[model samples]
Target: MTRIFNFSPGPAALPEPVLKQAQQELLNFRGLGVSVMEISHRGKEFMDVAEQAEADFRDLLQLPDNYHVFFMQGGASLQFSMVPLNLLGEKSTADYLNTGNWSTAAIKEARRLCDVNVVASSEDTNFDRIPALDTWKLSKDAAYLHITGNETIGGVEFHEYPDLGTTPLVSDMSSTLLSRPLDVEKFGVIYAGAQKNLGPAGMTIVVVRDDLVGLARANTPRLLDYQVYADSGSMANTPPTFAWYLCGLVFKWIKSLGGLTAMAEINSRKAKKLYAAIDESNYFTCPVAEADRSWMNIPFTLADAGRDGEFLELAKARGLLNLKGHRSVGGMRASIYNAVPEAAVDALIEFLREFEKREA
Candidate 1:
């Protein structure tokens, strides 16, 4: 009956309307006698749900006809290996931008399969800012250029995507997908874990260009092969039925709110307000650079690290939950994903002001 502004990043908060609709339909989905979770994924009813979800997703991103969308089971972490296993055809190198933790993980996975070329990295600065694109030393024949659209842990984001002329540009957009409008044609592949913006933790969405399919290595597992999933319509195995259905409902909810353009406006407004509060207050500090700060995840630090526990405790007492930052980078993180309303951000900002007064 009661819900706090839940913001624990992945498996993050979903829109309340979507949750309510799911609750209403949980027992019997749209007049069916069985729950959506109990239905057959291959059945016509589930098939229709899958098809419509893909369609709405394509509409949201305005994807071109050449792209094929696959609803896969692996999380975005799996794509770190899948990208290299499938895309690094013949070429021994792939260009990666080491912007933060996620990108570093992707690079490490790629290294196991191919020679990774880290073209640009912000690690020298402790991942506080994105390396300038012009400073990159790209390989002439790298298989694909990899980038993380948003670094959830470090709270850094790439405002503009790199222009990799001939090479395929692949991105791990796990944290920022569907938060705003994107040019689908700009990249050869885009993969996102569903938990952040899509739906639940069990599903991953992959959008790959037609030209990029059918190139998996000879030893690649059938399930791990992009072409295999493409051929079977992402039913290479029994997909996560419940997660897929919830994602479909989420897609529908997003469309009802006027699609990505409107969603972007809302996200931008919320981020700007939250960032302004952090900037104006000496009590809190956002380490990420202004130009590179993530609109989805905002990690900040209290003036005194010793007071971090108190801040989280008081914030939770006041109805703000999951404000703890990642373990690797200790502090506080406010993951304001699509489901997070503007009022939640306003409430958090007000809480920050009050907490500061009490602690000071």
Candidate 2:
């Protein structure tokens, strides 16, 4: 069997040990004699799983007592609407940072519910760089400032947190969550879809400050209301049991490997190696600014655009799967998430060298 290193952006690679553990318990989870997928989410066993998962995540993030972690069903996309629906209240305006496609989508959703002020934007620069924080035009009466911590499609990231003074800060951290350490106290809410560095596609993890829980609009649906989920422990409805279980394994795996600090060191080393390759080669170039480059997703282009398909084909033959970029971008993206081993990055570098030599 060919050993393939998957680099897909989401629904991406997961730790091998976690996968093996799931395989071992797939049909008979913890002597229950049924797949976790077949079990009731409200069952005591499942509740324990959910509780421990949340506890581990809180511990991993060093979450303060004021923060509440909720594992919900909707992807982070749903949070775009939920954020405004819950936090906007009587305020007619909110601030947004337009970093890339995801942030743009978030802004569009917020516009439907409130007067959105695009405080900072990189669209004029083709999403190649993060807008400088000093240039943002935050409104004095804005309800909250929303920013996408990492843009998956553009391969751009705000490595540092945005400052919005008294206005609450909300971030869509779908691609960057769990990839590194974060100061949980810096933001009012941080939400992530669970396919990148977490677990599967069905779960979204939200960490919201306790004080912000009861701010939902009067007509907000119970499911979309943060306060309801916070009050009920994210069990107001049936949750994605299997996905939650998988996330627990992932969190445990992260802990075994020394938590986010160690993970950040490894992720940084991986991105640096791949970016160094791209920057050094005349045949390849990365468009993002060095300061704003995403450690999880690195988008680069070939010097000769005509050879893009050829490069992808050769990369696939060598077991470097999913090296293609997002459809909107039309280039290559190597998403070196936590599960991607350093050896895989080294292998990719070797392939890049061989391919370039052949082209020359």
The TM-score values for the models, in the order shown, are 0.99, 0.98
Could you give candidate 1's per-residue lDDT for residues 87-112 as a string of tens digits?
88887899999999999999998889
True-vs-predicted CA distance for residue 302, candidate 2, Å: 0.6
| Candidate 2: C-alpha lDDT | 0.91
What's the C-alpha lDDT at position 46 in model 2?
92
lDDT of 1: 0.92
Residue 230, model 1, lDDT: 86
Give the least accurate 10-residue stretch of model 2, judged by summed lDDT. Answer: 158-167
- 31-148 in candidate 2: lDDT tens per residue? 9999888988888899899999988998899999999898988799899998988887778999998999999999988888999999988998999998987898889899899999
Most accurate candidate by lDDT: 1
| Model 2 residue 351 CA deviation in Å | 0.7
Tell me the whole-model lDDT of each prediction, alpha carbons only: 0.92, 0.91
